[model samples]
Target: MTTIAVTAPHAPSYYAASGLPQPARPALAGAVQADVCIVGGGYTGLSSALHLAEAGFKVVLLEASQVGWGASGRNGGQLVHSYSRDLDVIEARHGAAVARSLGSMAFEGAAIIRERIERYGIDCHFRPGSMFAALNERQVRQLEHHQALWQRHGHRELELLDAAQTARHIGSGRYKASLLDRSAGHVHPLRLAQGEAMAFESLGGVIHEASPVVRIERGDPAVVHTAAGQVRARFVIVAGNAYLGGLEPQLSGRSMPCGTQVIATEPLGERFPELMPTGHCVEDSNFLLDYFRLSADRRLLYGGGVIYGARDPAHIESIIRPKLERTFPQLRGVRIDYAWTGNFLLTLSRLPQVGRLAPNVYYSQGCSGHGVTFTHLIGRVLSEVIRGQAGRFDAFAGLPHLPFPGGRLLRVPFTALGAVYYDLRDRLGL
Candidate 1:
């Protein structure tokens, strides 16, 4: 694994500058015994620890850095439903039976987030409504099919808007139309992650920040070792995602770490509502899409673009500012207050990889860019599996995962070339 300095702070993003104050957690020192051991402090690990602790299991969670310090704290905060690949693609690849099952759980993750906020009184800025802005007739047709597919699967909260209607709602003339999912929403992602960790601690779960697991000994009771401590538990879950480098060779080859950048503009003041009249979160329909939403304090949190192998650029703003200006030319001179970069585990099929390595060693990763809501679902399902209920967990594990082509050395460059082809297609409106 890439060794993280113990004193590393949260990324200098808007999330770190203005979210709720997170509690300080100590590093793991002495050996501990628990029913379950979890690695990573992001949404997946924190949610797993919270759910497991609520199920009356002794849980210990270890993080290389502070809670929500990774992509969990650095996402665009769109609480979107479903997987990266929609149900139609899933049905085409797998079978209708599998698609039906996945479709049923598509909205469950968003619902879980709502319930947790109410149950725990989390202070994350929760907002309703998410829309996919269509730039052309082809995109509009896709949204039409998307709305119909979700409606068929019992998601009736979607409403398709014509070009005029879309312009009125979002106050942007760029889109031909949009599909609004009132059930989908946005939030202060970092706060939600930290709040989940706080809730877990309240339930007697133990957390050790800055304690990265270096090795895992697979046995009856798994032994997870850190530099200064070790956890002996009946079950172990690896939720490190993109940051989990070189840990488990058998499970790591199927996905690649892809980088993305985000920029938060200085408070938009009165211009915020003019850009988005309905105050809903907006994501484009392009394969490489732009997702933006207004923060509670009225700042625009915009994120887009991707790079395989996750080589972060030195000046994030230099690259992303032009993308933002192209989307909203009205905000051409708007000053960006913060910019940060993070990576998500991307799979070849653009679907998550969930399965058990050993009987007692489980993992869930490769949510692609759709990790915000799905991580919560995976966490709950993981807890269910550890508690003798494996139906939901098995459903996801059954999904096929293929390794990235070109092996480790060539996969990055190969994916970069593939991205170029896709970008051209997007530019040509294909």
Candidate 2:
């Protein structure tokens, strides 16, 4: 319900301060035509635009603010694979075939990212390796099953680490065990977004920043309208996850925007190795997780906790600093150089909602808390669907999406109550 302003500036986070320089792109000022028009300039839109343009489609991307101004720019920057709900959950809910289809493409997004980075020479400080740390025995057993599940889906670049082994990669004794995914990694999220934008433009795609789409006039050639101008295109892709307000009532109802806070410590310098020795990104295995990694400059960037209604916390540092220090007591009074919050769309099933708004109007949203890699895969699937290859897209589109039981009014409280139960379980190590 908290709509992002059209002219909003990027959050004052470490990524914004240290990201690659991107020139201001002009907003839409007049009517234009393209083969495809994309709403939102985050990963989804950028990937779709870049892929479509490479496939020889005239693509126009419209962003409410600047590219990556939303959660795409402000996330933990970990290149985590799969959906927020995981493949085992998908199988339990939707059956094996559905899980198999999704699992096949689970690692493709990270692959797409590496491919693009190499092809376009993106300088986002790409590092390859991510660890899912477990805090208790129960979580460790779950991770063991997790490794099997991923391996069943053909993902082989994984290693299960005991506590002693985990200590080598992660400098803390907080975790009981970990699962290291060599194929997974981290990056400067904002820089990656900007680099993708540059790649899209290099392929002759058009981007209009600060052009918040007012509405879409669905037709054979859909018209995406903004305050200053409009884009008439053969197809339209709605890639605005949480920042997408009431532009589409259908999308707004099934998903809720949840805010997560992150804080960056001052450069750790020599102490960086004392923290994360292997330089891999790490996220703990808790119901409400804590994720952290070393930045290119060796700063410890950490994030945790979720606000159900996307409300900015009164003090972000107060919320995140406690968790950061709890994980690493050595930095008890460490100065937090930057603290910020960003919203990601959370669906009832904690799975992404991918389907069509109309015959020519496509959409992908509700990445839950797993957008970094999934968004890229969704973009490619969207492009494939538009190119008359809807098999993969249909696999995702067929996933059932249900609105929250209480709908918009009480959805926040309902979800918060559920989160409380899970958090309690996490605390009890049940």
CA error at residue 196 for candidate 1, angstroms = 0.5
Best by TM-score: 2
lDDT of 1 by residue, 342-419 (tens): 989999899999999899999999999999989999999999999899988878999988887888888898888988
Residues 1-430, model 2: lDDT tens digits: 3233456778999999998888768889879999999999999999999989999999999999999999899999999999999998999999999999999999999999999999999999999999999999999999999999999899999999999999878888888999999999999999999999998888888899988999899898999999888999999999999989999989999999999999999987886457888889999999999999999998899999999989999799999888998889889999889999999999999999999999999999999998999999999999999999999999999988898988899999999999999999999999
Q: Name the 10 consecutive residues with the lowest summed lDDT in model 2.
A: 1-10
- TM-score against truth, every candidate: 0.97, 0.98
The per-candidate count of clashes, in order, stands at: 0, 0
Q: What's the true lDDT of residue 177 in model 1? A: 94
lDDT of 1 at 94: 94
Error of 1 at 15 (Å): 0.3
TM-score of 1: 0.97
